[model samples]
Target: MPDTSLPKTAADGDAGQGGGPVPRSTALVLLLLVILLWGVNWPVMKEVVGHMPPLTFAASRLLLGALSLLAFAAATRQLRVPHRGDLPLLLSVGFMQMTVFTLLVTVAVQHVPAGRAGILAYTTPLWVVPLALVFLGERVGWLKALGLLVGLAGVLVLFNPSAFDWAAPPVLLGNGLLMLAALIWAVNIVHVRAHRWIGTPLTLAPWQMGMAALLATAVALALEDVSRIDWSGHLVVLLVYNGPIATAFCFWAMVTVNRALPAITTSLAMLGVPVVGLVVSALWLGEPLTLTNLAGLGLIGAGLAAVALADTRRA
Candidate 1:
């Protein structure tokens, strides 16, 4: 997960000084693939968490992702240890982006439906708009502001009106935690943007993943029922898919795409996730596929596209 810390000026500098923009078609396709993998992530995570304790599942995924990134970094010769000044920022990013965010989402899935969780999580972009304006001094024009409003409306459509029902404490708590997780993720993005790492994506990713894995493992050992793991084929599959494909590959793809495209475009592409997640839920989990949900998805997509198009024009 990228941080929000980098000023627009810095990002502009990086884009100008680093490699120039990749082709729009290429960035779009890569982001679409990234969204698909991430969309399916909700259902996959929900299924895995059903059998394993949340923290343990999180730890396993992080560990697998870390290993994959480490191997890639080694093979690519991008393995550089962070300087002393960067250590604290890297560790903070690992905790907020990988460890806490993953753990919270895993636990939240236990309380809410995967589709609902997916929609809520994608609201990260909505939160990011305000944060970016305040911290990065990124101006939010009328169109972007409208996009934010429309996106939040979509979230409202997804939210179950009876969420406050007394019998569904877990569901309510899970929903709240998911929102908090989004905030943490947004903060991590800002942090990353603020402190542009000198290391390449290959090097930085492994460091973050490894730190997340270690921290998650420690928490899992302390708080979760580690002995209750089933060690079944399903569990193994989930770990492998979530770790190598979802975490490692997804992270790498996201970094590459973000480097190629503007932040707005990258965020826009992620709007496909809720749609994909809803489809996965309907097909795989037999969740109800209502017209309202579909309509909300459309609205969200339009809003995201508007933002992306506006950003592209500005650029």
Candidate 2:
């Protein structure tokens, strides 16, 4: 469930200070924390999925988050069942945002390094910017258009033939899957922005998360070998971290930041997730930090910042 204490908008200074717009500093801080949690989640997921099947690991994490949020909603008396009209939207969002996105990412990590996966996933903003313009009727300035081009150039840089032996089908397939996952995420974000679901975050979040858990669990049962799980100590720790901190807490924090910040700004803030993931993976996982990787990161960051700053000025 969303934090009840948090303000739904910055108009009333629900986050403190005067009853004005939320401070940029405060919004940035919250968004940065969200990035950090999500950034670390990649490597954590990679480690855990090493011991468990991808679908099963995703199922466990979602189930745990669902139970935790459900308990919180029940205890706080904040649970509200979705209306008939809202049910399909909520279920579709859950499937796209939670089940398909996580499952594809987990499977991709098995073939690609966590850092690479992080870099690929952050391309979501590139996709979202164009989608937003087309679907949401958001205007894209010349600067943002240039930024989108540069971001695509960065993707091409990362797609060098020498980066991975394309002869290896798994690696090629994994990269494609990661790209598909980003598209799914782009769609989910646009859907959320388009819909007018009438409920507080506390009431809505749990239902979406619970539905995702149930759906993921069902899929896992039908497809994955649950008996093959190693159930090691490291795996347990990673699952706990991914569920409670990364998924549950970060989801709420992201919603809070989104309410306070512009859509482009929020998406730009997520660029940090890949940066942190790359650095952390290099240090902890011994992943190589090559010149091409750094160059790609620089392009991505610059393009994202360009788009974000342009949006902020427009706002």
Candidate 3:
């Protein structure tokens, strides 16, 4: 899923830059598709790793997704190497957000339930509040502060001693890794906010994806047993979904929606991702949803809505 901390330029509407603004109806449809693809992908990735090593599966999908994005960029005549000045932001996003964050989520999903993993991973915006205060010198308005506290309360609820198994090493490791992934993504979002636009995020995405692909591949080769990969039809189907649909199409759709819709609308709507993930995981994987999970999800949605509204008001 795309970050909640949208760049200033994108938030302010860059629709006129490349092409005319998309129709609101069209943009909403695209946004819904993005939500479905990304939300369902949590369970998809969870299943993928069950059949192969996490890093290797991550590496393969990254490579294919990078290529697919490149093709999209080229077909649209938007393909170009990033400007020299964009390298710093590019490297930061590529390594921290795309590679490391993805690796952590992929690995952690092996031990964590996909529903809960989705909630934890998408907490990137909550982390962004603190990171932005430090890195961007942004003030914490009361609305945002309240939102942060509420969101964090939801996080604590998810980890409540009565509901969570704190004694399980695998559970602890998975939850910890997901939190780290959220923080890493938050850092990328702050950098995105601070970056001067040498290229629109869409224009630069393929390059960043390429870098991530290369780095993930190197790591996977060094650490993972590639031979363990099951070359089955199911694996192929899953990879196709991850590469072209989830990664490539969803990113493109999100950018389109960002340009067409108001920032607050986009951010608020994106919260549906974890909700969808939760429902899909329960139905598809037979993962039981507890009362604690429902309560936490409600609080998280409220918190995220408050934050999105606050951001729009601040803007």
State residue 231's C-alpha deviation in candidate 2, in Å: 2.5
Better of 1 and 3 by TM-score: 1
The TM-score ranking, best first, is 1, 2, 3
Largest lDDT belongs to which candidate? 3
Clashing residue pairs, backbone N/CA/C < 3 A, model 2: none
lDDT of 1 by residue, 1-315 (tens): 122223444443234223233456776777888899989998999899878888989999999999998898888777778655556556766778788988888889998899988887767776666666676656666776676667667767766565546567887799889889888877765555555444445556899889899999999999977988767898788788999999988876666565555444455456678778988998899988888787787777777776666665665
Which candidate comes out best when scored by TM-score?
Answer: 1
Question: What does the lDDT come to for candidate 1?
Answer: 0.74
Backbone clashes (count) for model 1: 15
Error of 3 at 231 (Å): 2.7
Candidate number with the higher TM-score (1 or 2): 1
How much is the lDDT of residue 101 in candidate 2? Answer: 88
Worst 10 residues of 1 by lDDT: 12-21
Q: Lowest summed-lDDT stretch of 10 residues in model 3?
A: 10-19
Evaluated at residue 206, the lDDT of candidate 2 is 79
TM per candidate? 0.87, 0.84, 0.81
Clashes of 3: 0
Lowest lDDT 10-mer window, candidate 2? 1-10
